[model samples]
Target: MSNKAQVLVIDDEPQIRKLLEITLESNGYEVSLAATAKEGIIIAANHPPDAIILDLGLPDESGHEVLIKLREWYINPVIILSVQSNEDDIVKALDNGANDYLVKPFRTGELLARIRSSLRIKISEENNPLITCGEMEFNLSARIVKKNNIIIKLTATEYTLISLMVKNEGKVLTHQYLLREVWGPGYINQSQYLRVFIAQLRKKIENDANHPEYIITESGVGYRFVCKE
Candidate 1:
């Protein structure tokens, strides 16, 4: 059999880290544990796992901070596993470099699915060049987004949603497509999230977010990105 997938679990709470270890090990993953972001970073730089699971409430430093530090060097996917369910927390983690997250008290099944999805994204991004839309550029190769010569921060979901639309520029992706691609098929019916995140992407990418020129709505259909002039 292939070697078990490697995962680094960073959380201050022993119970949370232990649970993650148990869940991941049982699911055929080799797990590493860190109780603080400081140690987490050291462990990550030394061992560089295939993926990372981080908690927002770290004992030494915030997970967002750790994410930023790791992102400077590590391109592997970082999934935030936090109890902080607020929109601000989610946005902060994603903007700082998290690939996805799970709300606290999450199900083992859901968590497993999320890890699988993240691994898929990491593999797909390998060897892919940057993608551009309008005045904005998404450097998939660099994991950076720039607009109008300025860096615009994007949450993981927001970035995923925008990247999908831009990659399929001019094609109106139905709500199902957007939802499934970003949030996964688990939230295919949550159409309102599409509205919220599209607005976020336009505000950061468009010359006039009020009347978007990059992302367009299709009335009864879904949204599409006009990537070419």
Candidate 2:
């Protein structure tokens, strides 16, 4: 197999596909193009790529439907590159298992960065199971969490939230993503629930809940788990 990371670009627009092909190929990546959702799905199923750039609009089928079908078996990153700028669309895409959402007219630099970030997280998860930050340690295989070498108690929801964040450490997980993953798809709009649980989680894990170092809130966007030592 070629060492170059492969990327599938699924878009109805020929120009967009061509542009992504050039950009991705120049960045030392292998590129595949599909002009419709059906074609994209077939290509993806036949030859899985390291990552996917999916457009939300397609001629035959909605890209959201395509994403749902892909997530049934496709484990790699799928970034939404769409013209929809509304929050609901973005949230819906992320809730449907998209790794990241980037509206159309995106900066090439930012798009590349998002791809790298997604790939990095996927690789790290496959290779490592024991995650540690500061005095906190998480043994994913055992579902055990320790702080300062002492066992700590957490509610089921709290544990789920923490594990999700830790798994996506060093990446900004949007409110929609976290809510969907932890509370399910129906609760995507319930940001206050996340706030309450996050507060409780911080109290249990952080040395100082007043100034958390582990979970950093991204203001209006979401929260990120900072695990860098």
The clash numbers for all candidates, in the given order, read: 0, 0
lDDT string, candidate 1, 1-229, tens digits: 4477899999999998889999999999999999999899999999899999998888788778888889999988888877845656765666576776678989998688678867865655544567666678888756688987688888877877777766555444566667888898899889888888888788788788899877877554467576544
Give a tens-digit lDDT track for model 2, residues 84-153: 5766776677778998867789999868877887898988877577988889999878888999999889
Worst 10 residues of 2 by lDDT: 84-93
Cα deviation of 103, candidate 1, in Å: 0.9
| Per-model TM-score on C-alpha atoms | 0.58, 0.69
Measured on C-alpha atoms, candidate 1 has an lDDT of 0.78
